[model samples]
Target: MDMSIVLQAGVATGTALLFATLGELLAERSGIMNLGVEGMMLLGAMAAYWVSAHYGVPWMGVIIGMLAAGLISQIHAFITINLRADQVVSGLSLNFLAAGVSVVLGEGLNSIKGVAILPSFTIPLLSQIPWIGKIFFTNQGILVYIGYLVFPLVWYFINRTRQGLHLRAVGEFPAAADSLGINVYRMRYLYVFIGGLFAGLAGAAISLSISPGWFSEKTTSGEGWIAVGLVIFAQWNPIRAAFGAYIFGALRRLVLDIQGPMMILGLANPFYYNPYFGFFLQMLPYAFTIIVLVLGSREAIKKRIGTPAALGIPYIRGERGM
Candidate 1:
């Protein structure tokens, strides 16, 4: 396979996963575990494809998809954050709800096997650079640019801003933030909703940019799950999350780009007839997560690379719990 094709595939995969991971990172940083990322992404992909197919403007599709996902995720956030419902159950329920709704809606809209896909758009001048230009700039959709732009902004927002500090405080210790006069409920809801929006946009980017005009039950596959794993792997850092996404993205693209090696290794063409290989490839990011966590769980590693102090813990006001 041509190196350019591989590079483009990596870029596309990274872009899609980048959105999902970034969103999840934000949500997690707010002390919310959103296992419903899959659902959000599916809804986003389906909604974006439908809108773009109908409106002839792919970006509009992405916006609509993100909004749809965000709206659905907000329901999850409300139940869990405001009502203090079980976060895991609520998230799982949202995932199922999203999948069912997207499938049914997609069938209704298309009345056929699949939805329409989007086309690529390359910018002038920037797209015309040498080999490096094609890898980073040329012949891609607008979503790619959006992903690149979001990285630095998200990094700055999380590390350098007061709002970001407040968010971190809320995640690390809600009671502390509460005592400090921060509205923990509001911040949690905001991050959760934003995470959903990003996941939705990521899903839309998959339909419009990566796969570009493909819509089926298997459209998102397990990319959302990988995004969730990427959150932990990135340690809630946007730039690191981007790198993690790229690693998984490259692996995913490799499955498509390289086909002959399996046969040479006495393995059948599992890509056909067996969809699990794709899932396994997608699982690599999660596997990496496990390795990192295990290694980092050691005292030596903990001293160097610790988890967020209050990950997965619920915060109650006036509680002395650490």
Candidate 2:
């Protein structure tokens, strides 16, 4: 394969995963575990493809796609945050719901097997960079650019802003934040909603850029789950999450580019099957997450690199319990 193709594939994958990971990082930092990312992504992809196909304006499709995914994710957030439902269960149910809805809706709209393919765009100056420039900028859709642009903004929002500090407080100790007059529930809702928006955008990127208007039952595959794992691997940092996504993207491209008799040798084949290699590569991010969690749990790492104190715990205003 040409180096340009490899670079393009890696950049595409990284851009797609980056949006998902960044969204998940935001949600997780707010003390919410959203497993419905896959579902939301699929819905977003379908919506984007459908709108783009029907209207002839790809940007509209992108907007609709993000809104659709964000809306679905908001349902999960509403139930889990306001209703005090089990966050994991709510997230899982949302995932299943989104997947089912996407399939049914796709069939209804297309009366065909799957979704339509999307178009690509090429910016002039940005696309003309060296090898890396072409891969990252040229021959890609606007969504890819948006994905890269969102990173620094996300970082600034999460680490440097007062709202970000409040968000962290809500995630770490809602009760403490509440005592300080912070609206814990409101903060959670806001972050969760924004997270959904990013997730939607991520899904749209896959549909619009990577798949390029193609949709299938396995549209998103397990990329959403990989994003969840990425959040853990990144320790809830957007900058770190981007790098983690790139690493995974490179691994994914490697699986795609490798060929010939090298398959028989374990050196070339990371898993038994080629397609399944994506799954194994996906697992790598999560495996790394476990390793980090374990290491972070140790006294040495804990003192220096600790998890958000109240992650996954429910916060009742007047209640005192773990």
C-alpha positional error of residue 206 in candidate 1 after TM-score superposition, expressed in Å: 1.3
lDDT, each prediction: 0.80, 0.76
Error of 2 at 233 (Å): 0.6
Model 1: which residue pairs collide? 117-213
Q: TM-score per candidate, in order?
A: 0.85, 0.83
Candidate 1 yields a Cα-based lDDT of: 0.80
Per-residue lDDT for 1-322 in model 1, tens only? 5667777778888888999999988888888888999889999998898897777777789889999999999988888876777888888999999998998887755443344455567777876888867877777767788788998899999899999999899888888889899998889889999999999999898877787654556888878887887776676788888887877777677766555344534566665556666667556655766775565346436666535566566666566984
Q: Cα lDDT for residue 289, model 2?
A: 54
- Model 2 CA deviation exceeding 4 Å by range: 108-129, 260-306
